[model samples]
Target chain A: MAPIRTAIIGLSSTATTSWASAAHLPYLLSARGRAKYQIVALCNSSVESAKRAIEVFKLPPETKAYGNPQDVADDKDIDLVVVSTRVDVHYETALPSVKAGKQVFVEWPLAHDVAHAKELVDAARVAGGRTLVGNQGREAPPIVKVKQLLEQGSIGKVFSSEVRAFGGTVDREALLPGLKYFTDRAIGGNIVTIGVGHLFDQVQYVIGEFQNIQSQLQLQRPNVLLRDPSTKKVVETVKSNVPDLIIIDGTLAASQIATDGANVLFRFRRGQQFPGDPALSWTINGEKGEIRLQAFGGSSLHAGSYGAPVTIEVHDFASDQVQKSEWSWQSWQEELAIVGRSVGVLYDKFAEGEFEGAPSFETALVRHEQLATVLAGWDEK
Target chain B: MAPIRTAIIGLSSTATTSWASAAHLPYLLSARGRAKYQIVALCNSSVESAKRAIEVFKLPPETKAYGNPQDVADDKDIDLVVVSTRVDVHYETALPSVKAGKQVFVEWPLAHDVAHAKELVDAARVAGGRTLVGNQGREAPPIVKVKQLLEQGSIGKVFSSEVRAFGGTVDREALLPGLKYFTDRAIGGNIVTIGVGHLFDQVQYVIGEFQNIQSQLQLQRPNVLLRDPSTKKVVETVKSNVPDLIIIDGTLAASQIATDGANVLFRFRRGQQFPGDPALSWTINGEKGEIRLQAFGGSSLHAGSYGAPVTIEVHDFASDQVQKSEWSWQSWQEELAIVGRSVGVLYDKFAEGEFEGAPSFETALVRHEQLATVLAGWDEK
Candidate 1:
């Protein structure tokens, strides 16, 4: 009720061009979401940097600024801990806070692998704390409406589904110092776990779940160029062990297409956004109706997944035409607009206590397990 | 070169609704194609019926009309024989003509089984006769353009492909006397061979062939309601052995998606159409670009495959936008317009002798064999 007192990790003092400043800080600071969240504490690499964040982000002069996450975790005033550090350190930053019984929210790729993700989930359960992973792909309005349309039988029985996604972290032709680690497969933040993983989670959210699947992953761009963040120029070329292409094909747990299984297919590619193609496209085929959703926002499955309106269309056998829904499905919120909009949705749902079961630790764990299944032959590929 | 004198088997006197009157006769009659083909003979179920076809089709008074295919085959004036009878009878009707050394074109599903198609090809080969089968799906202009685009590297290094098709003969809820035979799987003109086959052929025409594949077929619509040919009302019910859904997933003979294989997926369902959705949709995703083709013309694999334009769009990393080509890809050639357009394309190409290889009798035989591979577990389903 008291505006869940918050502490966001790695709150940069330099007013850096970071996701926290671009998405998280502005979102919680906005007048609209202000009533539900209040930043009480901030942490950076050093006490001096935290002090800079307080001034740059305009936190109250009295607000606590700490050099370490443990100091924030020790502060009894904070009710929530928001982890926005690099993927490699997400487990370390969020573990102590969750262990201290604070509701915790971690940016996706909850950890580099299923083991790390499970450990985080286990820690939260042990501490009796709540969790929210940054899997915001399904929180977008068009995505939410798809769930509604399916429930309303806008399309009779869904027989099959398909999804196509392109462009994400894999597009990092030359990355900054912080992002160089993402090119390593062991880090678990590459396209496979973060990009395809998020979209697949959204698919499961909209339709159902995958009962069985066969998957393929390929490293099309094996050599990744690393750049100095300040110079914005390539400094080193590293071998990329992560796959840039991802494919999953199989049956959905429930389907109108068949009793044994419903046909579902997915394909994802990285470092590629053909000029003018929708960033995300999906089709749900049904017996009596059909639905399609596409986003041209250059929306990737990773950290930044939005820019334009997520368009939704419906077609029924009776009308025999694809009718773009009239419902206003756009979020006009300016910066980080698309992903921000969905993040806002999750915040609202959390505020209303409707998201208690998920974006929760358990659901995130299940997705992690599925990603593990897809990783079975990753080494061989 | 005085226009190959032609005989069309099963030319219908019922100008009211025969496929011959609607598609074949009008197509050949059109001035554009007339220079290449001059109808010299017509044949139907009986001599009386053949005379009716001559009257209805307004054939020249000197044109020969025969009740039996053998009589038409025996005519020395006929240089090419075209068979348009039911699938079950195609083998018999086209046999004598092929053996007699006439250039022959048999409607697709050259027979209900592989053996018959092989026999037709064998007879044509031994007689040193040219052959064409009415597997006209690829002949469509848009389809032709797709092939051209792929060859031009519109999408570089094709990594994967997906195709979805719905609506066709598998929808036989009610049987018209003439079409009741389609409800029988033994007839082999059902969705798997006719529907998936045509689309797959189009794929081959564009992207080469599949080196290996796994397939699934389901009789979702197992029992069809028989109907009066004229009434359009259900009059009886019959068992349907044919599958309404077909699924194929495999590696292409050549792919840019991978070194071992580029992923390819195909799914086809029958008697189903979402109001505004295209009847057939395909996407080619490549390393550098992507291409999508969607036909709304309710374009099933059977006789009539359009209700809308076959839309084509290409996306390249250089362009980064989906550019729909501006081409008059539609035909106002009403009866069997979609199929007719392709047939016209073939006729023009055939006129120039460019279609020397296929959809020849031998090529059609290959497709029938593939369908046979799909039909292996038909009884269980």
Candidate 2:
């Protein structure tokens, strides 16, 4: 019944604020997470930083400090290794842990490329290591509700679906210093593999997986203005080859068998401005009625759809009533930071020894392969 | 400048309530209509019935009663002839007026067949007579608003669009007695030609017309149950050969030339059960943002999308606001009936000599030809 002993790479000290420091650490330190996970070691780019992390985050004196990922992965006391680093460094940091036979959780854009991601998947499989990636889609409460309703036939034989959303990746006027490399499509980290990939996974998770699909990707906005972090002024206009627009039209396998056959029309744009933003609108049209999810502001398909105030509306012909889904996330909200509540749910699943479909390294590998196919198909026409 | 003198063929008296009586008569009798149109004649199955119509409807003493459509069409004082009869008889009732050089308004499904509709178009063109058919789509206020918004670049460069709705036909339990003959597709008055035809016209009206398209039609519901007039009980079940489901995917010429092409995914289902009714949900995904129309009740593609309570929502990325269209129908709603208000708008268009897109016979012929293509294509696939 002891908690899973854990070590985290790129663990910044409390003196600095970062995604790793803000999103998962607080949850792990909370009452519910406290009973389930125990931090046993820390690794930073250097030993000085790792030592400072122990003091700043106030970890136990016995907790080891390591300067590199391999040292942390080699520690005998650690049962799980967590990698929280830049996309370019994910392979180097996570590969060691997979080889060490420790359960690992890596944040997404699973790796720099399919080759690196494949290496990680192969290592984990050979070592029989448990894995998790931060896909965090199935954990969203609204997604869960929608999936349940569809399975229960709330709309009665769904025939078609449509979605129009913003990936929020091309917010050119609002880029942080660290995101400059992300704009380079060469990094394999644009909206397609990151922002939209999360949403796409959710679509496949909620609706059935796509049996056949054809897609068009367009980089409509050629030049993007990067804002200065301190002065908040446009400093540089970067040429972006990464696609800001994605259009997909294909039939769902479920609908293909029905005499009427159902399909999907999905459009995800990049850099949705606030005033003119239609955050996310998805509709499942069925034989009896429809279930619609319209998020008014900042609602992305990935983690953002679970943010407070996401709306789920159902117009049921059988019941002859339009109803809004009712849900609660008090526990999640209590422990939440800027990161979404689904991460906590992710932690809970990992704690319960559940790994399937929870963004495991294997899941990320399959998604990476799908992304390669989409990128390849975009050039066919 | 004088009020357009009008004669109505098959105009039922107030002793019997019909679609014309409930939807148009009230509007025509209103003060605004009184100043613009003068009813000069009425035609019925017989002279006695015509006399009863005059007495029951309380027409002015100047109004003449006739036993046949030919007599009404031949009247020198009648500048316009309105035909409100069964589909099988539309050609017979309106053909004389076309030859007589009177501006004529005929109910939808302009004729029992495409050949007949083409004949009417040809006859009207040769006679140089204005003609209106009851497509009644552009006349709907919401449709007009959507078209105006799209034209104004409300959602810039619409690259993709989707619509999932029902034809509202094959609603075995919701049919009235007069619609009994419509169940027979051989008459060319079924959902494919009527329900979906109305919606398809509206789609083209808002977006640019489809430059190229293909379709699939299915007779999903093979049999329909008819309800009794007096008891509202299932009185009989009849076999149906007409298709109640239509699926179309095609590119709008607008998107084909743009870097990101705009396309449409449309599905019209039949026999949608209610309390779970999903009548209509349309999403136009563009470069700037999206405009969505979601109807709760019987919001089919035809006249239903323009009903007062129909919801039109817009997320304009340019404006940075998600908004619901604020529209008023004071002119039409003031004359609203238990049926709907679109009919009054249709009447207004006919009276004002605005024949361009107000469901003109030419437009109806085009739609009929389009329907023929769809039926032919359905067989091909």
Candidate 3:
């Protein structure tokens, strides 16, 4: 199958070094016997940053270095645009691409707030462009297994779920010299907007739609110690309005009526500085069984090890027995590698006419709408 | 101090075997140097049950037996009335005693609904009688340790709290026989009104008052199997309307600012026949440190030896260290024994005048009001 010519907006480190280079690029470039994609252009506010990212990520030598999002969006060679930019610029960068009739995959949190997200979703619909926001968790192996188990009645009916994700504070000292906007509440820096936002999307994707939400968002440390990116010295203090901690309780309508109901309790907080622990743990309970995931905060999956093994247990009602399984992902790279493999499978399915008539655009739009609602709550003063 | 003459109303097995013999009688009769109470009478729906309780608990020869609550309340020597009757009879048995100027300690729920509870509180207030409804958890040892830690700034300025308590269905067979009222929603049989009620009381006692609550309550199982008490046979089926699971997201007033806002998430559920595991866990986050308690439920705490341990870890900012503690209570009886020792100390302090004129009754009434508000939400159709 012909490769889907792809372009990327925003030449930040995450774009060049994180998901873009590690997961997206590898999956797009290496899926044998599957529909292929090629990165043909890179865009940034300055051509220099684009050129730097192109060199760092080893894009084709002929790839264009565009100075702005519109320049890349106007290129007819690009069939898909991947937006990995500052959350504040998501709508601005992605809207042009969607309007120009290209498929789009923006990172989690389509916009800083619901209104802008809705605007982007509406534009994609009118332009008839497919959208895929980066809630890559939907492709995770454990989640995929959980979904299959639910479909097969492994856990009779999922009545409730609890998810927790915590990590030490993101090291601001690591960002570029002038990228403080990422830490600003006005630009969406907090557990509610970023962490739980992704979790809710994943859970909703598997179970169903959320009917309502009641949440308590907290700014645990209002004043954060800022440090210089170059010297790593205390620079200044920035006031934070975004919640470092969030707790949400809500219901999800299950597909089957025999299933009692779905209850979700989620908590996310800034990581603790204490030793011997990473920050994330999740548990999902259905009528038949439960699955739990614990991840330590870091770019590495191994960081979450509590000197104990990670295990999954299943209860079989028919046999009246419980079964257990264990597997290890040595690093965050490995975890992302698993997700990347799944994306390849999806792409292969798409090429084999499996999704030729699938409602990819409509399904993605539904996810976008929910993301908007979360942002609306997040942006409340 | 001279012992205050006391009487027990409702001579059930829990009262005759557990409360009367194991807790109240032993404490009242042999609590030397700290014993400030004595049994004066025993009351039940019938003289036969009262006499049988008197025999089983080995009451003093002078202690009288009464079939009517008013008969006990009319006795000038009866200074305190312990209402350990079925929930439906709590108001009937305790109201007259409180109105008759007797201190009353009623078993929990206060009444079937908030309205009845409010009436009891008002009657006690009007008659100048002290009331301590049986939320004995408020006096538990571990809880006391937690409270002392918070008070002493072991973990400074609590900002968030997560609490979960769950268990298999309360033996409907054990509780429903001869108590048709147990199956009625108006009588408050299921999880939310009963189990979470106890949890909320304990939480409020330790934390403070909730400012608002958003909750989802569900009756997961529509029909529950009922068995014959004497024969131990499956004899019937009972319909359940009250929620088997309850989840709430709330904001609480800080112990300091009265409005310093603490975020709270709480969940209580019946043991799922399939997917659910019986468990209880709590975590509290403060400005300086965090404390976590996990694995807190089951018939025999040791019944699920394969489960995780109950752990308490504290991170102290002043010391720049994290400390850990763990203990196992093989049964609920052992857990209650730990509770008894803690309350015994408080009772000793009270008798020694450590809390002289401390307005303990007023503070207790305030807690009762909070419970009332929580129950009012559940009362809504």
Report, to 2 decimal places, the DockQ of model 1: 0.28
Report the lDDT of model 1 for residue B55: 84
| Candidate 1 CAPRI level | acceptable
Model 3 gets an lDDT of: 0.62
lDDT per residue as tens, model 3, B140-207: 54455566667777677887888766763544222434544545767744455556665676676677
Residue A189 CA error for candidate 2 (Å)?
3.2
Instruction: Provide the TM-score of chain B versus the true chain B for each model in turn.
Output: 0.91, 0.90, 0.81
Provide the lDDT at B246 for model 3.
Answer: 73
State the weakest 10-residue window (summed lDDT) of model 2 chain A: A252-261
Reference contacts preserved by each model:
0.36, 0.09, 0.41
lDDT, candidate 2, at A243 = 69
